[model samples]
Target chain A: MPPSGIRRRPGGRSARVRATVLAAVDALLAEVGDEGLTLDAVAERSGVHRTTLYRRWGSVPMLLVDLLDAGTEDDWRAPDTGSLEGDLVAINREVHAALTAEPSVTAAVVAASFRSPEAGEALRRFWEDRYERCAAVVHRAVERGEVPPGTDPRRLLVAATGPLYHQRILLGGPLTREEADAHARAARAAAASGLL
Target chain B: MPPSGIRRRPGGRSARVRATVLAAVDALLAEVGDEGLTLDAVAERSGVHRTTLYRRWGSVPMLLVDLLDAGTEDDWRAPDTGSLEGDLVAINREVHAALTAEPSVTAAVVAASFRSPEAGEALRRFWEDRYERCAAVVHRAVERGEVPPGTDPRRLLVAATGPLYHQRILLGGPLTREEADAHARAARAAAASGLL
Candidate 1:
C-alpha cells in the first residue's frame, strides 16, 4: 500500500474529489435546482470540506460554467436519416425529451446561464459545438440534392428546433412528438421552397 | 394628520406597500437577475419589514408569479400592419428587443420559471395571453386571404417568433432585426404554402 502522504497526494486524490463534488452539483440541481445550489450545500452533499470547494470552484457562477463545460466532453452528433425532415424530427425528439425530463438538466442549465454572464458564455460554446455537429445533416441534404446549395444549415436547424425549445422551456406548454415533427416538416418544406 | 395607526392602516397603506415592494422586485431583478432575488433583499430595498414580505409574497416562487402577474395589467396589442408578413415582423421586433435588453426582464422572467413550478405556470398564462392577443393579426391575414381558411394562427406565430427566442436566449448568439424579419418571412411563406 502507498504511504499516507503518497495516498493523499494531489493528482489522483484531486481528480476523485472533483468528480465527487461535480456529481453533487447535479444532485443539488436535480433536487433544489440552481437557486438552492450554494458552495456550502455542495460541500455538504459532496462530503468535501468547504475550504476545498471555495478554493477550487470559488463561486456558483464558476461552478455552473464548469458544469456546462463538462458537457463538451460528450460525443453528441446530429441524427442522419437520409433526409432533412427525418433528421430534424430525430434531433428535436432528443431535445424535447431532455426538456421534458423531470428536473430537466437542460432546463436547469439554461436557467443557470441566465443567472450569470459567465455561465451564459459557457452555454454558448456548448451550443456552438452542438450546432456545428448538427450542421452535417444540412450538408448531407445538400449533397443528396434534397435542398439546393447555399442552404444555411444553422438557420434551417434553428427553424426546425426553435419551437420545441420555446414551447417546452419558456412557455411551459404541452409539447408532443407530433408537434416536434410538424415543426421539422415546416422547416423541411420551407427549405425546399428556398425560404429558410 | 390622522393618527399613526390610522395612517398605516390596512386599505391604502397595504396598497402602497405592495406597490413599493413589487417595484423593489424589478430593481433587484435588473441589478442581479432572479438568482440574486430574495425576500430579505426586497425588504431591505423597499423599506418594508421582512415579516410583511413573508406574510404577503411568502416565497420566491410566489413573488415571481406576482411579478409576472403585474405585466398582465398592461394594455398591449399586436401591430395592425395590414399584412401577415408585416405583422409578424412587428411582433418579433418587440420580442427581440425585450430579450436583448441589457438586464433583460424577459430573460430573467423566463429563467425564473425554470426555478419553480408556480412561476412556470404564471409565465404560461402570461405567454398565453400574449399569444391570444397576437392571434388577431392572423385573423386579419385570414380575412385578407393571405393564407387558407384553416391556417392555424398559433403554429404560424410560434414558427415566426420561436427562432428569435432560441437565438437570443438559448444560443446566446448574435441577433438582429433583419434575422427576426427573415424568420417572419419564412413563417409567412410556410403559412401560405399550407404547411404550417
Candidate 2:
C-alpha cells in the first residue's frame, strides 16, 4: 500500500484515536457529569495531547457533540415483540434502563446540550435518528392491524416514551420498569382509540 | 407602630430588594440563556451590591432556585372548565405558550437545574407544586362524572404535558399549540379508559 493510503485504512491509528478519546469522554461524563467535563480532562484521561484536542474538537461541547454523533445509531434496531403493547413496553424498558442506569452518560450529554446550541443540534440529530429507527415498531403494528391506519408513528412514539423521560430526566424522580410499562399501556390504549 | 413592627411590614424594604433582584435574574436568564447569567450581572442590573448577592444567594444556581421559588405559586390556580378535556386543553395551552415564548426564562431555568443539585431540587419543587395545582382540574372532572373514580391526577397531568417538554426542550423541535392539545386529548382518552 502507498504511504498516504495507509492512513485511510479501516481500524487504522486515526480510528483508534477517536475510539479511545470518545470512550474517555463517556467515562468522564458518567463520573463527573457535564459540569466537570472539560477538554483538559479528556486529554489528561485519554493521554492525547491537549494541542490535538484543541485543534480538533476546540471545546467540551464540541467533544460532547462528536461523542453523541459517534453513537450506535446504525447498529441498533427496534425489537420485534409481535404485538404493539409488547413492543412499546420493550421500548420503554430500554429507555428507562438507559435513563436510570448508574452514572448514565445520557443524562450528562442531555444537560450539556442546554449549554451549547451546537450540542443541542447534535441532540436533535440523535433523537431524530432514534425516532427513525423506532418508527419500525409503529409500522409493524400498522401491518398487524394493531393500530389505526395512518396512526402517526411520531405521535405514538412521543406519547409512549415522553412520560418516562419526564419522570426520570425532567422531574428527577424514581422510575421503575413497571411504571414505564404503565406508560406504555397508556400509549397503547390511546393509540387503539385513535387519539394519537 | 413599634420599630420591630415597622420592619416586618408587608412589601417592606427587604421584600422589595428580593423582588428587584429576582426580576433581574429573570431578565438575564431570558437574555443570556443560563450561560451568560452571573451574580455580578444580577447585582449590576438590580442595583444591589455583589456583596449582598454573595451573602444571600451565593451562586448562580441558588439565585435561579430563588427566582423560581418566588413565582406565583399562590396566585395561580387551575382552570375549572367543567370537563376534563376542556381543562386539559386549557392547561396545555398555558404550558405551550410559556415554553414557546421568545427568549423564555423557562428554558434557561430548566437548563440551569442540570448544573447544580440545589437547582434540580428547586425544579422538582416547582413541578410538584404545579402538579398539585393542576390536580384540581382532574378532581372537578371526577365530580362532574367526566372521568372514572380514583383516576390519578399526577399521571394524567404528566401525560397531558410531558410531550411538549420532550419535543421542545429535550428534542429541540418546533411545538405548535395544536400538537399540545393532541397530547391533552390523548391524556383525556387514556384517563377515560382508566389507562392513566
Candidate 3:
C-alpha cells in the first residue's frame, strides 16, 4: 500500500486529479458533445468522487471553462524561426492541426461558447492569452526588418487563422495543410504590403 | 372561411406553413439552442401538427437545414455598386449583421453542423449557393478593370468574410462596422497585390 496515512506532496495529488478530470471531460465532449455532458457523468467517467467534482468544478459550464483553459495552456507557445513567414506558418499549422485533430472537441467547446456565458468568458481569455503569448513573433519580425513597424501581431495572427476557422466551422469545409500554408502566405503578403 | 372549400392557390398555404415552421425553429433555437430543440417542441410552438412536421421536415436536422436554406435565400443577394470595394464592403456588412443580429441562431446552426451529417450537408449547400450567387461582385470588378483578370471570386469573398466569422464565432469577439470595412479594405489590398 502506498503510504495511506502519509501527507501527499503539495499539489501532486491535486494536479493528478485535475488531469484525470480534464481528460474525462475531453473524452465525454468527444463522445457525446457538450449537450449530453454532466458533472455526474464526468465523475463516473473520471472515477473522481462526485462531491469532489461538485466542489471543484461546480457546474458543467465551469468544468468546460476549466477544460478550455487547461487545453490552451499547453500548445500555444510562439515559434521563432528567424523569419516572419516561418513563424506565422508554424502558428497557423499548429492551429490547423489542433482544430482538425479533435474537431469534435473543438465543436463542443464552440457550441458551449454560444450556450454558456462562463464558457464564452473562458474562450475569450484563452484567445487573449494566446494572442499575448504569440505577440513576440511580430516583434521579432519587426526587429529583423522583415515587416514595417506598427504591424499589429494580433491582427496578422487573426488574418492568418481566420480563413481556416471559417472554412472549418462556418462553411463546414475541410481545412487542408495546403490551405493552412496558403493562409499563412497570404497573411505574410498582406503584412509585407502593410495591410495588417 | 371565405374560400375554405375552394382549391387553394398553389404554394400559398404551403409557403405560410414553411414560414411559420421556420420562424418557430428560429425562436426555439434562440431560446434553448439546437440541443434542446425537437420537432415536437417546434410543433407545439409552430401550431403545426407533429405528423405534418414529420412528413415535411422528417427530423430536427432537416428542419434546421431547411431553415438555413430559406434564411440564406432571402438575405444573400449580391450587392453591386459598380465597384469591387463597394460591393465587397456591402457583402461584409451584411454578413456581419446577420451573424451578429442572431448569434444564438447562428450558433445553434453551427452546432448542428457538427453533430449531424445531414445538417452539415445542408450548411455546405447553403454556403455553396451563397457563394455562387455572390460571385458576380468579383466578376463585375474584373470586368470594370478594378481587379486583375482571373481573380478568384470565391477566394476573394472568403478572404473578405473569413475574419468576421472568425471573430464572431471562434473568438467570440464583437465585429464592428469599422472592422468589417477594414476587412473589406484589406481583402481589396490583398487582391490588388495579387495575393488572393
Q: Write the per-residue lDDT of candidate 2 for residues B98-158, one digit (tens) a residue.
A: 8897777878788888768798888889888888989989888888887898788988898
What DockQ values do the models have?
A: 0.50, 0.64, 0.41
Candidate 2's C-alpha runs over 4 A off are: A1-11, A35-55, B1-11, B27-55
What TM-score does each of the candidates earn?
0.75, 0.87, 0.79
Candidate with better DockQ, 1 vs 2: 2
The TM-score, computed over Cα atoms with residue i paired to residue i, of candidate 1 is 0.75
Best by TM-score: 2
Clash number for candidate 3:
0
Give residue A97's lDDT in candidate 3 (0 to 100): 83
Clashing pairs in 2: none
Off by over 4 Å in 3: A1-6, A23-55, A58-63, A72-76, A102-104, A112-117, B1-10, B20-63, B72-76, B102-108, B111-120, B142-150
Candidate 2 similarity to native, TM-score: 0.87
Candidate 3 lDDT, A1-196, residue by residue in tens: 1554235653677788899999999999888888779988999999999899999889898998998789577865799888989998898888788678653777678768766779988988887888888899989988988878978787788878888778776786777887787778778877877877
Q: How far is candidate 3 from the true structure (C-alpha RMSD, Å)?
A: 4.2
Interface RMSD of each: 1.6, 1.2, 2.3
Clashing pairs in 1: none
Q: Is candidate 1 or candidate 3 better by DockQ?
A: 1
* Candidates ranked by lDDT: 2, 1, 3
Return the number of clashes found in candidate 2: 0
